[model samples]
Target: MRAEVHAYVADAARLNRQPVLVLDPLTALDCSEAGYAEWFTEVTEGIEAHRALVVLKDKECEAESPRTTMMTVGVRNLRAAAPGAMVFLDATQLARKQDPPGVARTLATWSVKETAGVAINVGEHTPQAVADRYGIELRQTLAVTTGRRDLYVVADSSRGGVASADGCNPSDARIGSYEVLSDNPETTQHLWLTTPGISDGPCGSAPASKPGQFVPELATGLLAGTP
Candidate 1:
């Protein structure tokens, strides 16, 4: 797969040989260098000449000329090589397929405030872990998160706050022919589920004085979660 990706990148010109390969997002990527030729040809010309049912209007060529039937006459516009300092190649087999010092440079360029700035560590890693891995020092800084049980207390509670979704989105989707969508375990988890074409996933469990008011327990801290 790496060989195919390398070949395809060289041929199609995806990043223009940028150093960072960014392998995390390629979890299920399914492109092959072998398929590039067929795809490029189809995209450029072959498919249209074979499948076109009606004549297209063109200013450059007479309708009788075969070039008119080709997808792009004179190859006036379309080019396979991407136009950028970076390269981007895409092919399918239906299938196919960064970091460091760059960080120092970015931090230096931005003059990032060491004490005030906090890092967002995505996935299973803690922000502290990310900073440590990347050599970014955030002395005495902390990040609040929702998915984990970790917590730290300072003299001031206002410094950090929870970042979590306020509530679940009630599903509106249904199967074909009006079959109601059954969220099952997830549907049962919510405070209330709305009938289709009725409440439109009304928030806050649908039982309060105001129609859209935040529940009394959550009202105070929800805005902090956002800000």
Candidate 2:
């Protein structure tokens, strides 16, 4: 599994794309402290070599605060091994037992300044419900071009007005989707914007147009700096 992960990262880096690596420490739990340290060192070195982002899913078990300790160790190791890479904590498990807002705040506070951000899976939960829990507002609607199959536009709401148009016109060949955008533009962030029941899966359905079909022409009219 680890070797597969390394290959995935290397492939993404070779193509000049960023890859996100998700890790669950079930195996690490059984290893001795020294063994765990060595494992983490090797993992961090691999991540540094590939310049990938990591998401650690902190799960609780019988041991007293094992997740908390593992998170601490993981963050410390990453900072030492790969200071340039980003780390995200997926605290969906913890959020199940506690208030989402409180959990989000606590994780943000506990995280190091360099720690990228935190995420909650909210599986089987409505996006609105989760947003309300975090006190996040839906400030804008983005009508991203369905024309570009490979491109997904991610904008920070706090940065304000990612694109010129607020809503899509009837003639537009784009889909209107919403998300909780970040305030900080410098953060490494990605968002998926899809209508309800519209699966963004690769083999789902064919889009009406080809890649760059509408964006180039639309950008000339909408984007400020485009000629």
Candidate number of the best lDDT: 2
Q: Candidate 1, residues 103-159: lDDT per residue as tens digits?
A: 323322222221112122211111222223332221112221122111111011111
Model 2 Cα shift for residue 108 (angstroms): 5.6
The lDDT values for all models are: 0.23, 0.45
Quote the positional error of residue 162 for candidate 2 in Å: 25
Best by TM-score: 2
Scored against the true structure, residue 62 in model 2 reaches a CA lDDT of: 54
lDDT of prediction 2: 0.45
For residue 200, what is the lDDT in candidate 2? Answer: 21
lDDT of 1: 0.23
Q: What TM-scores do the predictions have?
A: 0.15, 0.54
Write the residue-wise lDDT of candidate 2 on 1-227 in tens digits: 45776787889988998776666665563534454566677677676656876766566645544555667677778778877566766655555566644564445444523465554432212233333333221111101111112211132121122322222211222322234345553322333322222222222122343321333333222233423
